[model samples]
Target chain A: MSATQTNDAPPEPGSHRRGLLWDGMLPEALGLCLVAIIFGGLAAGYLVTDYSWKQQSAAAHKAETEAVAQAMATALGCVADADGRSRAGEAPDVAAGPRTGRPSEQVELLMRELGRLPGLRSMHWTREGEAPAEPYREGEAPAEPYWEGEAPAEPRRDCSMVVTVAVRTLGGEPAGELRVERSASADAGYRSLLLWNWGTPTGITLLVFVALYRRLKRHLRPMVAIERNLHSCAQGLEQELQTLTLSDSLGRAAQGWNHLIEQLTQLHQRLQEAQGAEQADVMARFEGAVFRRVVDRLPIGVICVTNSHTISYANASAAALLQRGPDELVGRAVDKAIENPAVMQAVVAAQARSGAGLSVDHTSRDGDQETTLRFRILPVSAQSPSGDALITVEDISQLREGERARDNFLYHVTHELRTPLTNISAYVETLTQPGFDDEQTRKECYNVIVSETKRLSSLIENILTVSQLEVGTARLDVGEVDLTRLVRQMVQDNLAAADEKRIDLTLSLPPKVPKMRGDKQRLCILLNNLIGNAVKYTPAGGQVQVNLEVAENRLVLAVSDTGIGIAAEDQAQVFDKFYRATADAVQAVPGTGLGLALAREVARLHGGEIHLESELGQGSTFTIELPWPTSDQKVTR
Target chain B: MSRILVAEDDPHILRLISMWLKRQGHDVLEARHGLAARDLLQAEPVDVLISDINMPGLDGLELIEAVVPAGLVRRGVVVLTNRWDHGEIRTRLAAWGVHVLPKPFSPSRLSELIESLTSSDVTEPQA
Candidate 1:
């Protein structure tokens, strides 16, 4: 269920997360800077060489134009031409110059004519006649070489070169200086050479950059894939994987990512398990789930109350027994939920005790009735009642009632048994007296002993019957008989007792009362008991009526006695064993209290019921309801 | 002989007790239950009132309660009960100087209880 690994080599996964600068732009920008540094240095050196080449080319162009001027000057002669006199024409310019010598008038025109070169900016000669005369040239050596002419007004912004040459006659004396300015326009040949100087190196550097970029991309591809995969999986933490086969750092990084994800997945699962382990119910982790379930399913009520007097938990059985809902019981104050001071006192006492706990039985009165409860408060923890105390509240009212009943029964039986026994003992003791028994006294004593023994025997028989019926030890002998005939016979058998009391005993039987499927002997006993009780209870001259009727598919054998009747309070208990109606007249009558109880038990065993109606002084009625046998049932006549 | 009042619900037990008390040289008057016993205690001077706890009307405890104020049965009461489980009830009665005789008691035990009651003062009968 667990996997623990130790690898101390790698960085923590979270630490390696790429910052903005490190992810993509840093490597490429650094590469581009390196490329730019090397190439930029080469371009700077090429630029310096091209600047000097332009200077030298412009100088060579100007030198060539100056040489043309020098050749023309050498060809000029300042001597008199042809006539030795100045053949200065009347016009300022001659149309053609003698091929041998140059005239001053034509010199200016010829110099202007030499300005026809294509790159020529200007060709101008400064003559002595155009020079501004100085005021004090007396000590100057003929102002040799005529002060450099005022700087020419060259207006064009192009690479220009200037040359000044002195004009001399054949003897080479200075006549005037011709100034020539030439600009070199970029020609195809020059351009081809310039391109070779700078363009080739730049193109080569671009190729190198392309190769470097490819290498960087190849190296970073896995890392980028890893980052992308990790980010995409960042939400779920366990999803797609970006795998690589390279043994480089990037490949290992991928493996590391997988490992981190695995660790995170395991940790996530642990977190989920922790959440699952949380118990939302009142039963915390102190008890096992199965144990709680079993406790909840118990038939005994259980409540856990905190030291603070709050009902911390109540099981379903507790709720049902308390007649409160489970939710209503928990978190409620103990005084409110239990509401019985006696039970609460016992609970507090138990809480004050330690270890295996304490218990007390209490009877709680709810309105008119009372129920007995046994509260066993147990310790939940070492803290005892400082925490929740486990209380097992068992409603033992029924059990206490049963014990009381048994006690009453035993008491009655002993009283009954003791009476006859006492009589037998007394009479037998008298018989043993020294000659104290006369014949007549002896007969009376003997008769008393016999009757007492008979009483004892009948009491024992009835006690045995009651015991058998109560414990279900005796089974009914089921049979069918004419219920109407049986009822009439029972009444007839009881007529003597009625007559002895001077009670008017009469029978009313439906002509065709339905026969019943039952134990015929028990049915007869049921009827005999009802009628005998009626006759015995009726005063002299009071009417005792026995009516057997069939109604609603039942045989109702009703015996009503017009005598001192049982009180309304004792009616419910008339069928309880060892219970007698405690009125004066009824108490004066001597009869065991087992007849009605036995009769009712027999009736119930035969699927019937006994009902009673009475008033204190008017009369009493007892009815035995037996189910009428249907046509399918076989009736024994 | 000390005139003792015996209150019991069962007739045969009452007769047996009366006979035994007569044999013991005690003048015994009988009542079927607590009501008749209360009447007898009021109408006559008795030494001891022996009674049953459960009866139809005015049971033994009520009889004792009634007679104690009337100063009947000056020698104290002897309570006979068939309820064997009433230890607490017995204790409550014991506070009143009541002696207990459980039902089905032996004649010897009864004799001892009566002897203990009558011998306490060794005084002649007042009535």
Candidate 2:
């Protein structure tokens, strides 16, 4: 499911987004189209209303201009008639007052009446061909109808109209010409009204569009979040299913999606639990956390590699054995972690679940320390999702060393046993033969045979005891040991051997000796071995001392021999089973080399330890220390 | 009588070999270890050298190693060892034309080998 989702899901939701509504492209496009249509309609309405306003304002302006011209023409006609009557010697009656029949007075009266018309700038009358009729003016004089100081309050240059009207007499005959100029300031009010007409509707349409977009954005927010989250889930970018929930504010569709996601999460959890149960069933003894803990704490290394050829899990021991950091081996290629081709092939075979498991030993050297590791590669059952191949590594250097030691022990034992066997065989064969059978020679042969047989039996016995002690199969005859008596008896047993070499063999004991709880026979064997070795190794006239001291709640028995001592290099390994020193002095004496090892083992069984102190050509001492049992604790099991 | 040297660490084996060789009317020389045997050979070369492999001071192999090239023994060298598992040492001894006898061997067999050595003029075994 995750793979399919990852392959099918588009690049996350927010990338390359085109604005706030990018996620809902269809709605955004639709909203944009509607806004564009509304804006286009408002613009068209504005253009038409502007055109109509322009036409009405233009017509009203033309009418106002024509009316001012007509009023000026009528006033000029009255003035012209009055002037003509005065020229013809007749009195011209005027509405304001009686005329004096002077043309200037009549023109003054005409200026006053026409200037009162709101738009009239100035009026000029020409009689027949009179010299411009003095260019009749409104303010003070007719100077282009604009006074220098009072320029008609800054009138627009294009807002003025010029009208020429030919005046006629009262009988409708042409009398004089009248030219009138009027300011068209009244048209500015109409133009402002047109702007107001266009602006109000456009602003209202834009306001409505913005309000709708904001509302749509509020509704789309939850939807975009849900979409992005779904894409993330499909891509397997989110591990936590609960974090993919949509807000309840997003209505029923979102609530339904969240409910489906919740169910999916629960199903995933159940599947994992089922897998865990299967794994537990397969591993009958250990399950889940307990299995993990056991594997981690095991002395052997365990590495689990998935079918993908990568390590999925490596226990702590595995990491330590691999000499890597705790997490270094995990997620690395199996071949890379295990450099041996045989081991890698075994791992591959295990992962394939073919053939029986293969085990290989790999030897590596780091400086002076050489290590032998045994790798056992086994296949995990198919039900486990965690791993396909399980590789276990055990450091078998010590085990191999033990095997070598055992082989050496056998070789030495056989060699030592064969010496007496050869003697017994040669002597027995000589006895069977009838040549030169002197009684003296026969007596000698019988004695040699008997003694060789005894030597052979003793060697065999020592080998068995040492083997039993080493393998921990020897049953201890536990008893309260009288150290003083045991020491005396052991020393007494070795006195003859010491006396043969003319060595001074002595024993020293403290005033009080504490009894110890231990194996009596093994203790006797231990003391006899030490004391006998001292006597055997000491040269003629050398001293052999057995001292028993009880101090610091412990018993220390030390046997010091003034003889050819052990070399420093061989001292450490002297107690190892069947390890006879190759030194000439050590080899000069006949020994099976199991004495000290057996002695040490016996001491250990009694909760004691043996220590060796020796110098070449100087004397040697073997010290056995045991915890002095208290009076009440002397009870033996 | 041919002179024969018996080098052994064990007293009983040494005495038995000496007694057998002496009974055969062969002049027998005895040494407890390889070093003493080597000293005896250095003083006067023997016709046959019967040696044990394990000894103090120097081992039988080392003694033979020192003696064979120097012609310390006239006719043959015999090795008595219990280390049957030492294949490498055995191979080396074979290459040196030395005879090996594992321990607990027959006394009659040993007597036959010494008799052949004393009777033959050949210093090397026939291929």
Candidate 3:
């Protein structure tokens, strides 16, 4: 069968137009038939009335002529001779007037007898089948002298419009006919009556035509507008489907039609979903189940869009990243499912096989949290029927945050290192210059160079140690470490710095102590950072004390300083890497914020934890608690 | 002698700059940070304003942004920074028409730059 005959085939073109035209023609043809019926009815009524009018008028006309004829015959009888002389052509001896002719005498006699009647034309006498004859007085015999003495000559008259009757002698033998023509006024009356009969029906027909025309226009106008709108949409001239609405003029039909349009819109959406499913089917035919399972299990979001721009496959991660259900993403249009414009643009570009591919970042905020997803479009090269391109989405919020933190760290580290290096470099140059050959200037430059060099070396060491601690790469050099000696040595190391600032540094130890197993170098470094920071930050008269004791089966080593303490808010984050309080006192003291963080890490590595007690602007004490060594490992020295 | 104002947070670098400028026969003013430099500039105009980019209070660019517009520096402003690779800072410094000298620079070279600034006509500051 042809495609047109198939059940799945699309509707034929022009079918809507044909249907609309037919719809329009129904009312038009009906209106035309109505008009014809009214006209036909009026015409038939006019014809019947005219025929009856003509019959009645004919009878009335005949009665009028017969009465005139009878009057004329009576007049003739009055004027006729009793004897045969009057019939034979004898002149009647009537009162003699000025008129002398026989026809004039007859006319005068008839006028005198019958007087003048209304609606009378000329009167004449005629024999059967013969031309109208003259008056009886026109014969040779003279009639009585014309009544009233005078007679006028005969006037012209129509013979066809006349009513006629036979005239007879006193013996009742057939005589010549009498004829009377109707007057113009009498015929005008019949014409006016016929016109009056047709006027009413014509008026009624006109009223009905107007009513029908108005009603049909009201009923069909909305349908026509809807039809036009639909036709424009189907022809791709209009993009908005909601434009297919019927005005309220159609009443319930309008509501029903609008409802139908809504259903059609939903059907269009379903059709798009069906197209996506078909595309998925195509993809399924080309790729195996193993590939599907692998893609579904992938951590990153993977979405495949067919060449037709429908989503053929969307992995679980893709659905989750898009915040949609797994099945909701597949079998949908790429643009509709993916609300990110830049990603959609990249997908379109990839579908055209443009360039290698494009990568776009989509950032979405859900309340307080912001998620950044990177979409990379890769064009399919194998001509697989699955899809035109592949899009991979990776949630890169953490990655980007890490990059930002590293950049910040690098910036601060470089700036910190540059300060001491600049000091060292400038002082060394000053020492070389000739003006700086003096004893005081030379001594000053040497002292600056030595201190700056030491600062630079220590800063570099701190950075390396902290980075290693953070990355879990720092290997511990485990050994037996005497806690009392370690504390004494660390305090001694910071004595010169404390003395320079006039701060008292002291260490106290119990009478007896045991050496614990730990990383000795790391322990020394940790104690040095704490003691050094105490002396550097303390005021000229502030005191720092390092005390070691055994309690609770753990080594309780405390380093307390009467320096600028941490604020309550900053205390929690003071141990975080590269976190520096923005206090003026803290900023004025040149120390890497890595010290406390590194100290904590080193303490944790030896299975110990550091506790802090601080009051802003009063003092701070850092206490370390370490588990005591086991009996076999412990050495009392 | 041309008057020069040097702002640096590092005490040793500040001393070395002061020593070099003094040996060059110029009167030099000193500030420990950008805020002090702003205060000095507001007090008196100078032939040159030399500053370090990183400081505890109000950084070098901010100091220049405050003083240069008020016409405190006579010749031009010069920047000493280690943060030359910082894109936003670099762009801002470029837009200001300030000459940037990275750290670990030679004292003799710095002396020559100071000499040039004192002898040259006033360099207009860019926005």
Cα displacement (angstroms), candidate 3, residue A275, comes to 32
B1-127 per-residue lDDT for model 2 (tens digits): 8999999988888888888888889999999998999999999999999998889998988998999789898888888887875466668777567887888887789989888888877766622
Q: Per-residue lDDT for B1-127 in model 1, tens only?
A: 7889999887666766776678789999998877888888889869888887776677778888788667787786777776655575567665457777776566556767787788788433221
DockQ of each: 0.16, 0.49, 0.40
Positional deviation of residue A205's Cα in model 1 after best superposition, in angstroms: 56
**Candidate that beats the other on TM-score, 1 or 3, i.e. the better one:** 3
- By DockQ rank, best first, the candidates go 2, 3, 1
Instruction: Put down candidate 1 lDDT per residue, A1-637, tens digits, no spaces.
Output: 2333222233345554563325657766877787785678477647754685677677777678778767655434342122123454343222224433434434444544565565765555555356633322334543222222222254222466777767665444565655665665666545665667677766776777778778876656556655444454565664422221223445566566567666766787788787767644334655677788988999998898887778888899889877897799988988888866765765666566545677767676889788887878775576552666778889898899889899888878887787677668767766776543678657867888998997798688779989988887866666557777887788888888788778899999777765556777767667877888888787889999888777887777788989788898988888988888767677766677998998888877776788889898888998877776533233222
Q: Which TM-score values does chain B get in all models?
A: 0.88, 0.93, 0.90
Model 3 clash tally, residue pairs: 3
| Candidate 3 global lDDT | 0.75
Quantify all predictions' global Cα lDDT against the true fold. Answer: 0.69, 0.78, 0.75
TM-score of each: 0.51, 0.54, 0.59
- Residues forming the 10-long window of minimal summed lDDT in candidate 3 chain A: A1-10
Better of 2 and 3 by TM-score: 3
